[model samples]
Target: METTHGAEHVHVGRDGWLFLTAGSNNVVGQFSRSRLMARRVRGWRRLVVARVRGCERLGCRYLHVIVPEKLTVYDHKLSAGLRVKVRLSPALRLRRALFWHRSARRACLDLVGAFRAVRDARDLYFRTDSHWSFAGCDTAYRLICAACGAVPKDLSGEPQEWRQMAGDLGSKLTPPQSERWPIRGLQRDAVRVHASPIVELRERTGRADKLHVGAHVIYRNDAAGTDPRRVVLFGDSYAHFAPIMLTALIAETFAEVHFVWSSSLDWGYVERVRPDLVIGQVAERFMFELPDDRFDLKAYAAERFGTELAEAEAKSARKPGKNSDKSPGKKPGKAGTSVAGP
Candidate 1:
C-alpha cells in the first residue's frame, strides 16, 4: 500500500506502474463527488444527444468514445494511499446521465467495462506512459468496429518488434525510466492521400506540437475486404492519424477515413465530407471543458500559422528556377508524433 512520489505529477505505484494523479486536467480531482462534476455529466449527456441527432439528420451513424485514463482502469496497481474510486470516473458519470436518452445504446461505447473485463490478462496500457499500448488500442478498435457493424481486422498476426523508449510519464521522472514497448509492424494498406497546410508546415519544422489544434489528414484504403463506408473521426492523440494507432485501425477497416486532431467537432467539415459514419473520441480527463462544436479547423490553422506559411511561400517564390506551383513545403515524411498528457 506504499506510494512513492516520483515526478511532480506522477504517482509511482507498484511494479513500475506510474499513474497520473495531477496535471492540467486534475486527473485525481475528476473522481470527486462534487456539484461541478454533476453539472459536467449533464453537459456531456446533452452533447452526446446533440451529436446523435445531428448525425441522424445526415444519415450517418455516430459513436462517442471516451478513452479512460490508466488510473480508472488500472487503479488496483496504484498505492493504497491514493484514494480514488473508479466508479466516480467522469466517463461512467456521463454514461449514467445518458442512460435515459433513447440514443444511449447506439451513441456511446462502453470502454470502461471492456477494459476492466480483461485488464488482468495482460497490460493494456504502458507501465510508464500515459498512453495505451497496442493491446489497449486494439481492444478499443475492435469495440468501435463492432459498434459500427464493420468487421474488425485482426492485426494481432501482424509483425511486431520491441523498442525501448521513455514515455510521457517516465520522462517526467528525475532520472527518466524507459520501457520496452511492443511496436506492431503493421503492413498498412491505407495510404495518406492528403494533409493540411499546417500539418505540412509543422512536419517540415519538426514541431508537430505547434498549431496542432487543426491538424488533419485523410487515409484511403484500396485493399480487399475493407468496409465500403467513409468515416470522419474527430479525436485527440489517442486516435492519431498515424499507422501505429487507432486511426490506422479504422482506416484499415473502412474504405476512407478522415482524422482530425481536435476534440471539438466541425459540423461544416462533417457536412462537406458527408461520411457514412462519424466518430468522436476524447480522453476522459478532458471532460472538464465542453466543446461548442464551433471549431473551424481550417480557420484555426490559418490564424495560427498564416504568417509562417506566408513567409515560407514568399521565400520559395524568391528562389530562381524553382517551381512556384508546387506546395510551399515538402510532403511530410512521417506521421506527426504525439506525447500523451498527464
Candidate 2:
C-alpha cells in the first residue's frame, strides 16, 4: 500500500489555503498579517455549531483539543465516519471547481501536448489505469522520436492488432496496492510481442551443461524492400509499454525492435545487444537506492570515472595541504604543506 507521509491536504495557490471546515464548508481567504486567515462569517457560525453538536453526539473526547498529537481508537473510528459523511457531497463539487481552476486546466493542456507528441492516442497509456497507459506509451514513443529528431514513418500497412496476451513484465511487477485498490478485475489492454530469437528458459535432466538458446530471423518475401532502423531497448517493465507502442505505430520506421525488462538481465546484456539508444527505466522513488551487486550502476560509474575525479581531488588536496603545513618561518600563503583541506 502507498504509505502516508502526513495528514492529507490540497494546495490551492498563493492567495490562500482552502481548509475543510467543521460542516464541510470550504474556508478560503487571503493570508492576513494577523494569525487567523479569516474570522467566521454569520452563516458559518451556525454550521460550526452543528458540527460541534455532531461531534458531541459521536462522543468526540478530543474535539476541544485542536490537532491531537496522536489519534486514539475512538478518535480514529469517529474521524473516519465523520470524514466519509463530510466529504461525500463536497468532493464532487470541489472536483468541478478544480476543473475550472486555471493551473489545473493548464496542466491538462500540457498533457494534451504530450499526447499529440505521440500522435497515436491508442498507444498513450494502459487500458485500465493512468500509470503509463497504452496510450501513454504511444505518446512517449512520439516524444522519443521527436527528441532524436527522427522522421517517423506511418505504419498503417504494418501488422498491428489488439490481442489479449497475458500480463507483461509491467503488470507482473505491479505493487500489491494496485491489486488491492478499490477498482479490481478491470480489463487491461495487452499486446502480443513478436521478436526474433525469442529466448525461453527451462529445466533439464542429465548433464544440463548446454544453455538451450535459439535464434531466428524472418525476411519479408515482398518485392518492395522496406528499410527501417533496427532498435533494441534494455530496461525495466516501464520500457515494455513504450517499445510496444512505438513498434505498433512506426513498425516500418524500424526494421526490427527488441525490448527486454531488467528482471532477467545480466550486466553485459546491454553491451551484448548493442542498440542505437539505451533507455534505463528506473522508478524515481527508488533511483538512489543501490541495486543488486551485479547491477550496481553507481559502483560501475565510479569505477569508470572515479579515477579522474579522485585525481582532481588529490591535486586540490595537495595545494591546501602545502599551505597549511607551512613552518613558523613561512608566510600566511605557505600555511599548508602537511595540512589538507577538510
Candidate 3:
C-alpha cells in the first residue's frame, strides 16, 4: 500500500518517479499500455462536440488544451514490469478520440510532444506534483497565445531560476521522502503585477482546493500587445499552471478575460461574459471524465433559471393536445450536480 500514492492510484517508480494507474479497473497496472476504452473516449468526444457547438452558438472561439500525463513525458522511467505490460496506450486512445471529432481534432492541442522537443533543454513539469513546473506553464502560455492570436512581447530574455520546494504530491509523503526538491519557477521580477487580482466569487463550501474563487484579470503593457478581445477559459488544477499565467501575460490582448476554476461550463456566465474565445483544459489522467461530461448542463440551466423555466414548462405541459413537459422540474435542480475533480 505504501507503494501507492493515493487510493492506490499512483505507482512509485524509479528515481522517485510517480505514475498514475491507467484504467480504474486495473489500478495495479501502472504504465500498462492496456487496451483503449473506446466507449469512454466516445463519450469524451460527444462532450467536446456539445461544448464546441455551445461555444459557437455564443460566438466564441473554442480551444481545448490537454495536459500531458507524467508517464507520457517520462515513460523511460517506468519499471520493467509495468513497461512490458504493453497492450494499449492511452495516448493513442486520446488521439483516436481526437480524430473522431474533426472540430476538436483541429482545436485540441496536447503539449507532451512540444515538451519533449525542449524537455532535454529544460524541465517542463514538476517531478512530483501532477501539475507542471513554471517552465512548462511558460511553454503552454506561448502555445495558448499563438492559438488565441495574441502576440506577446519577447520574454525569452526574461529572468528565470529554479526554486526548491515540496510539491503537492511530495507534501503528502512523510519522512526523508518529503524533502524539498528543485522546481523550475519564474523569477519574481518575471511576473509583473500592475494591479491586485480580484476575487469574483468564492464557492463558500466544497473541496478546499476547488474553493479557490478565481477572478479574471488582464495584465498588459500600454506600450504593447494586440488589440483587445474576449476570452472565457475553464479548467482543473492544471489551469493553475497555464491559463492563469496566460491571463497575466496576455490579458491585455483580450478585451475581457473570464477564468472559471470550475471544470463545468457556466453557460449563463459564458452568455454574460460573451467572450470571443473559449478554452477548456484538464490534466490527461482526468480526461476519462471530461469536465463537460461531469457537469449536468440541463440541470444547471434549470437551477440558474428554475422558477421561470418551471413555470413555462408547466404552462406548455397543460397546453391542449401538447406533449407533457415532464422533464424540466422533475426534481428541484438536481441537475446542478457536482463537477468532480482532483
lDDT tens digits, residues 1-342, model 1? 232364768888888898888878888998989888888888888889989999999989889999999989998898768868889999988888787886865678999999999999978899989988888989999999888789998887744777898888888886787799777755378777777776777777787755446778887787888898989999988887657788888988998888998888999889888999999999999997788798887787778778988898888888998888887754543343211100
lDDT of 2: 0.29
* Model 2, runs deviating above 4 Å: 1-130, 153-228, 241-252, 263-267, 283-342
Candidate 2 per-residue C-alpha lDDT over 52-102 given as tens digits, one digit per residue, 9 for 90 to 100: 343334332101101100010011222222322222222122223335343
Instruction: Flag regions of model 3 displaced more than 4 Å.
Output: 1-9, 22-36, 84-92, 153-163, 174-223, 241-247, 250-253, 293-342
Error of 3 at 333 (Å): 32
What is the Å distance of residue 37 in model 1 from its true position? Answer: 1.0
Off by over 4 Å in 1: 1-6, 158-160, 185-187, 209-211, 329-342
Write the number of the candidate with greater lDDT, choosing between 1 and 3. 1
- Candidate 3 clash pair list: 33-88, 34-88, 229-255
Q: lDDT for model 1, on a 0 to 1 scale?
A: 0.83
RMSD (Cα, Å) of model 1: 5.0
Model 1 poorest 10 in a row by lDDT? 333-342
Give the alpha carbon lDDT tens digit for every residue of 93-123 in model 3.
5556678578777677757667767876765
Q: Please, what is the TM-score per model?
A: 0.91, 0.31, 0.66
- In angstroms, give how far residue 206 of model 1 lies from its true place: 2.9
